[model samples]
Target chain A: MSSRNRIESVAHQTVQKSGLKNLSFRTLGAEVGVKSSSVHYHFPEKSDLGGALIQRYRQSLATTLAEIDDASPNAYDAIKLFSKLFTQECSEGKICFAGMLAAEVEFLNESNREGLQAIFNMYHTWLLDQLNQAGDELKIDLPTPTVAHLLLASLEGALLIDRAHPTNDRLSSVNILIDSWFGKIN
Target chain B: MSSRNRIESVAHQTVQKSGLKNLSFRTLGAEVGVKSSSVHYHFPEKSDLGGALIQRYRQSLATTLAEIDDASPNAYDAIKLFSKLFTQECSEGKICFAGMLAAEVEFLNESNREGLQAIFNMYHTWLLDQLNQAGDELKIDLPTPTVAHLLLASLEGALLIDRAHPTNDRLSSVNILIDSWFGKIN
Candidate 1:
C-alpha cells in the first residue's frame, strides 16, 4: 500500500478504538513505521487527517449500500446486510469511523465536522431510499424516514452499549433491533 | 448549594455538552467562579469528579425508576418515563453524562470506569425488570432483556444521531421506536 493509504488505515483503527481527538501525527508515525515528519508530509494538519478519514469512510459506505441494493430482494435483507457492517465492527471491539466521529463531534475541527455531517446525510438519504422502495409491499407501520433514523441511530448506539456494558450475548441489541423490524431472523 | 456541589453540577453539564476528557478543573473553575486550585480542593482529582458524577447520576436514576414504577401501570408507560430522561438531554444538545463517559471510556481513570459500568448495570437491571413484568400482558414479541437493551441503546444513539445529523424531525427515531413497541403513542 502507498504510505498515505497506510496512514489513513491506521488512523481509522485508532479512531475506532480510542477516538479522533487522541490521534496524533507522532503516534501515526510510530504505528505506520514512518517518521513523524513523513506523516506530516502527507497530511500537515490534524484536521486534514480527520477530513481524510471521514471522506474515505463516506465513499466506502456508499459503495457498500449500492452493493446491498444490487443483492437484497427487499428492505429486510437490505437492513440485515447493512447491520452486518455494524455487528462486524462491534465484535472487533471498535465502533465504526462515522460513529466514532459522531461520538466525538464536539471535539471536531470545522472541516472534520462538516465532513461528519455529510457522511450522516449520505447515510440517511440512502437508507431512506431503500426503506421507501420496500414500504408499500411491506406491512411496516412507521414512515420510511422514521425507520431509517431509528435504525441508524440505534445501531450507532449499539456500539457504545456493547463496548461499555457488554452483554453475555454482545449482539443482543443488534439482533433484537432486527427482530423488531421483521420478526426473528434466528 | 455547597460550593463543592456547585462545582459538580457545572462539571456535569460541561461533560454532557462536550465529554469527560475535556472537563478540566480550570474550565470548571471559570464556569463556577472559583480558582483552578479551588476546584481541585473540592475534588482533588479529575477522576474524583467523574466518579461523583456517575455516583450522583446512578442515585438519581434509581430514584426516577422507583417513581416510574409507582406511576406506570405497565412497561409501556415505564419505558416512556425512562425515555424522557434521554429526550430531555437531547433537546439541550447534550448527551447524558453516562453516554459522554461511555464514549470517552478509553481516556478514563479506573475508578471512573467502574463507576460507569455499575451505572449501566443498574440501568439495565431496572429496565429489564420493568419489561419482564409487562411481558405476558403486552403483545411485544421480543424477550425482556432484548427489549430493554434495544430501548436503552437506541435512545442513547438517538442523542448522537440527533446531534450529528440534526434531522428535520429530531424525535422521529424516538417516536418510531415507541411506535414499534406499542403502536403510535399519539
Candidate 2:
C-alpha cells in the first residue's frame, strides 16, 4: 500500500480499539512504522486524518453491504446475513464506525456526522427490504421503520453490554436475541 | 466541599464534555481551583480518580432515582418522573457514565467495567418496576422486561445522537417516543 493508505489503515485500528476521541497522529505513525512527521506529511492535522478515516470507514461499510446476496436468499437468510455481517464487524473490532460515531454524535464533525447518518440509512434500507420480503414469504406483520430502529439500537446495545462484561457466549446470545425477535413475531 | 468531592465535580464536566478517555487530573485540578499536587494527594493515580468519579456518579443516580415518586399520581407519571430525572442528569454534565463506558468497553479496566454494569442494573431494576406497574394499571400484555430494555437502549442511543446533532428537540422527542410506546401497548 501507498504511504497515505498505510497511514489510514493504521489510524483505523487506533480509532477502533481506542476511540476517535483518543486518536493521535503520532501514535498512528508509530503503528505504521513511520515517524509522526512523516504521517503529518500526508495529513496535516488530526481533523484531516479523522475526516479521511471516517470516509474510508463509510466506504468499507458500503462495500460490505454490497456484497450481501439480498436477491438470492429468502428473507430469513437475508436478515440473518445482514445481522451476521454486523456482528462479525463488531467482533473483529469495536463497532461500525458510523454506529460508534452516532453514539457520540455530539462530538462528531459535520462531515463525520453526515457520513454516519448516511451509513445507518443504507443499513436501514437493506433491513427494510429484507423484512418486506420476509413478510411476503411468511405472511407476517413485520414491524415498521421504528421497529427496525429499535432492533438496530438493541443490537448495538447488546454488543456494548457483551464486550463490557466479556463473556465468550454473550456475542452469540446477542445474535440469538435479535434473530429470535424476528422469528417470534413472524 | 472536600478536595476529593471538588475534583469529582470538575472531572464530571470534563468527562461528560470531552469523554472519560480524555479525562486528566491536571485539567480537573485546574477546573476545581486546586493545585495538581493536591489533587494527587487525594487521588494518587488515574484509576483511583476514575473509581472515585464512578462512585460519585452512582451516588447521584441513586439519589435521583430515590427522589422519583414510585407511588406517584399514576404509573405514567412515575415513568415520566424517572425519564425526566435521566434527562436532568445528562444535562447537568454527568451524562450516563455507563453509556460512555459502553462505547469504549474494549479499553476499560475491570473495576470500570463492573461499575458500568452495576449502574445499568440499577437503572434496569427501576425500569422493570415502572413497567410492571404500568402493565397492571393499563391492563396490557406488553413484555415488561424486554420493553424496558428496549426503552433504556433507545434512550441511551438517542442521547448520543442528540449530542452529536446538538438539539434539545431530540431530547424532547425521546421522551415522547418512550411515552408513546408504553401508551400504545399498555
Candidate 3:
C-alpha cells in the first residue's frame, strides 16, 4: 500500500476495534511506521482523516452494492446477498464503519456527517428498489418503503447486538425478517 | 446531589454524547467541577465508570418498563410507551449509552460486556412477554420472539439513525412497526 493508504488502513482498524473517538493520528502514524507529523502531512486535521475514511468506505460500499445487485438473478437473491454482507461483518467480531459512525454521529463534523448519512441513504435507495421489485416479482403486498427501512435498520442493529454478544446468536435477524416477508428463502 | 451521584450523571451525558472511549476522568471532573482525582476516587477505572453508567441505565429502564406496563391497558399501549422512550432520547439529539457501547464493543471489558448484554437480555425477555400477550389479546398470529427482536432492534437502530440525522426524521420507525402489527397505535 502507499503511505497514505497505509495510514488509513491502520486507522480504519483502530476505529473498528474501538471507535472514531479513540482514533489518533499519532497512533496510526506509529502503526504505519511514520512520524505523527508525517501522518498530519497527509491529512491536515483529525476530521480530515475521518472524512477521508468515510469517503473511502462509501466508495467501497457503493461498489459492493452495485456488484451484489448485478450478480443476483432476482430481488430475493439480491436481498439474501445484501443481508450476508452485514452478518459477515458481524461474524468477523467487528462493527462496520457505517455502524461505527452512526454510533458516534454526534462527534462527527459536517463532512463526516454527510459521508456517513450518504451511506445509509445509499442503503435506503438500494433496498427500496430491491423491495419494490420484490413486491412485483413475488406477487405479494410488500410495503416497499417501510419494509425497506425495517430490513436496513434491523440488519444494522443486529450488527451492534452481534458484536456485544456474538456467541449468543440463536436466531439471525435477517433470516427472521426475510422468512416473514417471503415465507423462507430456501 | 451527592458527589458520587453527580459524577455518574455527568459521566452518563459524556457517554451519550460520544462513545465510552471518549469518557475521561479529567473531563468528567472538569464538567462536574471537581478534580480528576476526585472522579478517579469515585470510579477508579474507565471500565468502572462504564459499568456504573450501564447499571444506572438498566435500572431506569426496568423502572420505566414496569411503569409503562402498569399504566397501559394492553400490549398496544405498552408498546407505544416503550417506543416513545427511545424516540424521545433521539429527539434530544443523543444516542442511548447502550448504542454507544455497542458501537465500541471491541473496547469493552467483561464487566461492561455483561452490563450491556444484560440490558439487551432484559429487553428481549420483556418484549417477548408483551408480544405473547398481544398475540392472545389481538387474536393475531405472531412469532413472539422474532417479532420482539425486530421491535427491539428496530427501535434501538432508529435511535442511532435518528442521532445521525435528527432533523431528517421523515418517518417514525416505531409507528411503522406498530402500524404493521396493530394497524396504528393512536
Candidate 4:
C-alpha cells in the first residue's frame, strides 16, 4: 500500500482499538513507519484524516452490502449478514468504527461530522431497500424506513451492550430477536 | 453540593460534552470554582472521577426506574419513560455519560471499567424485571434477558444514530419500534 493508504489503514485500526479521541497523527505515523510530518503531508489536519477515514469506510460498507445483496438468498439472510459484520468487529474487541465516532460526534469537526452522517444515511438507505425487497418477497408488512431504522439501531445498540458486558451473547440475541420479529409477521 | 459532589458533577458534564479524553482536572476545577489540587484531593485520578460519575449515574438511574415503576401503568409505559430519559439527554446535545464512556472502555482504568459495567448490568436487570412483569401481566412470552439486551442496545444505538443525523426522529422511532414489538405479543 502507498503511504496514504497505510496511514488510513493504521488509523482505522487505532480508532477501533481505542477511539477517535485517542487517534493522533504521531501514533499513526509510528504504526505506518512514517514521520508525523509525512502523515500530515497526506492529510493536513486530524479532521481531514477523519473525513477521509469515514469516506473510505462508506465505500467499504457499500462494497460489502453489494456483495451481501448478490450472495444472500433472502432478506433474513441479508440482515443476518449485516449483524455478523458488527459481531465480527466486537469479537475482535472493537466497536463499529462509525458507532465509536458517533459517540464522539459533538467533538468532531464539520468535515468529519458530514462524513459520519453520510455513512449512517447510506446504511439507513441500504437497509430500507433490503427491507422493502424482503417485505415484498415474503408477503409481509415490513414498515419500510421505520423498520429499517429499528434494525440499524438494534444492531448498533447490541454491539454497545456487548462491549460493556461481553458474555451476554448480544449479537446472537439480536439475530434471534430479529428472527422472532419476522416469525411474528409470517 | 459538597466539593466532591461538585467536582463529580462537573466532570460528568465535561465527559458528556467532549468525551472522557477531553475531560481534565483543571477544566473541571475551573467549572466548579476550585483549584486543580483541591479537585484531586476529592478524586485523585481521572478514573476515580469517572468511576464516581458512573456510580452517581447508576444511582440516578435507579431512582428514575423506581419512580417509573411507581408511576407507569404498565410495562409499555415504563419502557417509553425509560426511552424518554435518553431522548431528553440527546435533545440537550449530550449522549449518555455511560454510553460515551463505553466507547472508550479500553483506555479506562479498572475502576472506571467496573463502574461502567455495573451501570449497564443494572439497566439490564431492571429492564429484564420490567419485561418479565409485563409478560406476566399480558400473558406474553418474554425471552428473558435477550430482549432486555435488545431494548437497551436499540435505545443506545438510536441515540448514537440520532447524534449523527439530528434531523431524524430516532428517539420516537425507537419508542414506536419497541411499542410495536410489545403490540405483537399483545
Chain A alone, TM-score per model: 0.91, 0.84, 0.90, 0.90
Per-residue alpha-carbon lDDT of candidate 3 for residues B1-186, written as tens digits (9 for 90 to 100)? 998999998778777777778777887899889999998888888888888889999999899888988998889888878887766755466676777788877788988899999998888898888878885554324467777777777776767776675643423744666765775532
Candidate 2 CAPRI grade: acceptable
Task: Please provide, for model 1 over B1-186, each residue's C-alpha lDDT reduced to its tens digit, 9 standing for 90 to 100.
Answer: 988889888888888888878777887898889999998886788887888888898898788879888999877788787787657755565776787788878788878888898988888899889777875555566677777777777777778767776663535567566756775433
By DockQ rank, best first, the candidates go 4, 1, 3, 2
Model 3 ranges off by over 4 Å: A138-142, A168-171, B137-142, B167-171
Give the DockQ (C-alpha) for candidate 2.
Answer: 0.32
TM-score of chain A, cand. 4 = 0.90
Pairs that collide, model 1? none
Candidate 1 lDDT over residue span A19-117, tens digit each: 888777898899999999998898888888888888898888889889988899988788788888656755555776787787778888778888888
- Model 4 Cα lDDT, one tens digit per residue, B61-174: 889889988999898888788888756765566777777787777778877788888988888888888888885443334376777887788788888888788865566667
Candidate 1 is graded, for docking, as medium
Model 4 spans with C-alpha error above 4 angstroms = A136-142, A184-186, B136-142, B184-186
**Local distance difference test, candidate 4:** 0.78
lDDT of 3 by residue, A21-57 (tens): 7777778888999999999999998899999898888
Report how far off residue A168 is in candidate 4 (Å).
4.2
Q: What's the TM-score, to 2 decimals, of chain B in model 2?
A: 0.87
Better of 1 and 4 by DockQ: 4
Tens-digit lDDT track for model 4 on A1-186? 798998998888888767777788887899889899999899998888888889899999999989988999888888778877756765666788888888887778888888898988888888888887785454324366777887788888777767766775666667876676567432
lDDT of each: 0.77, 0.66, 0.76, 0.78
